[model samples]
Target: MRPAMLIRLALLALLVAFIVTPETFAPVFQPFTKNGAPAIYTQTSLLSLTLSHLAIVAVATVAATLFSVGLAIIVTRPFGVEFLPLSRSIANIGQTFPPVAVLALAVPMFGFGPIPTLIALFLYGLLPIFENALTGLTNLPGNVSEAARGVGMTGRQRLTQVEFPLALPVILAGVRLSVVISLATATIGSTVAAKTLGEVIIAGLLSNNTAFVLQGGLVVGVLALLIHDAFVMFERSIARRTGRLY
Candidate 1:
């Protein structure tokens, strides 16, 4: 294995040992009576929540990818040049919005469920995905774009056949960012009865049990790491196939 891959494996193994053997640290953070079943308090509930949150991340990512790439193409055109700043502003606003507050506000209309949570996650995820895609596609060599035109490629054809493929690595990198943030933020959904790992963390805070909170926090961190690494590997694979990145 490559040195970097070996190092990552060692670190991941350490994390697994720490999480799976939480009892080993009992002397430090002893077992408090948690709300869930004893087994649930370990990793079972945490894992389930993380997986649910991944579904939320997937939805938000796909939506953002379509929106961003479409807007990038439109605004890059001569007739659409006036709208680039507007597109950028929208993306910036999405990033700047408070996801928790967004979820809370959305509760009144959406009626206290995963919808608000999904919306918040969607907003939080959209910006980076949109911006990075915009940057990635727009930053390519002008000559390449010109060559596409010289070959009688229509706008859609050039975007699909050339631009999107070239920009996919940056897009995937944005997705990794969105997934990590979504995983960490999904815990906020628990307040609105959203099924996420955040329930444990929130409950831990309410009951003032540091161990409970630590377990949830630790799980979220590890899940984010795993998701990020997985996406990055997937991104590298795609980029290599297209010869867009190494």
Candidate 2:
């Protein structure tokens, strides 16, 4: 009903149409190509490339979330507090190291494919989620935590029932950032023979086909926007349920 929601739905529909029946829109891209060059990327189905691209990002983001959140939980515990700096350094490794370098290093051991890409993405996505989780877990209202303890809740029970739930919106915010970054970065995985939307962009670059480049970039940009919006909606929903939303 809202204009923003309507626009998002329209974008989603157009993205699906582009992926499922790209050739039908070739005429729209005709002006961007040479007089006789193909106006759309046809070597691989856009739908397949999109799906593969999402799969890689999803897998990497999930892996990063689990590791980062778990590490955050550990470091927040009394016994694990001393390890906080070490944990921060470990999470920072991904951001400090170049993704291309990670890919190059991983290729020999993992071989050219999604595996190397997954390694690069997984490492790259860690810092945001880790930092957010740490912030959320550490910044809880003192009274709420005291109340949980006053109710005779064990540390583990309080964490599982109260702390984690309250912190979820913040954690989700980090996950959203990680996912968006991974979506764009995963395109680089194509250099190592990974199946991704980057294939279209790379082919276009090699052939000097603006149409191909535009199609690839447009699809990736739209996907990132849609995913970002989806995360925002989910984060807001969680915040509302947790009484964190105004």
Model 1, residue pairs in steric clash: 187-198
Model 2: per-residue Cα lDDT over 50-75, one tens digit each: 99999999999999999999999999
Model 1 RMSD to the real structure? 3.7
Leading candidate by lDDT:
2
Give the alpha-carbon lDDT of every model: 0.76, 0.96
Cα RMSDs, all models: 3.7, 0.7
Question: Which digits, one per residue and each the tens of the lDDT, describe model 1 over residues 1-246?
Answer: 899678678767865665556566555556554454342255344445666766776776677677776777788777888998888887776668798789868999989768888888877877888778778888877889999999999988998899888888988898789878888888888899887777778777777777778777877787787778878898998889877775
Candidate 2 local Cα displacement, residue 137, angstroms = 0.4
TM-score of each: 0.83, 0.99
RMSD of candidate 2 to the truth, in angstroms, is 0.7
Number of colliding residue pairs in model 2: 0
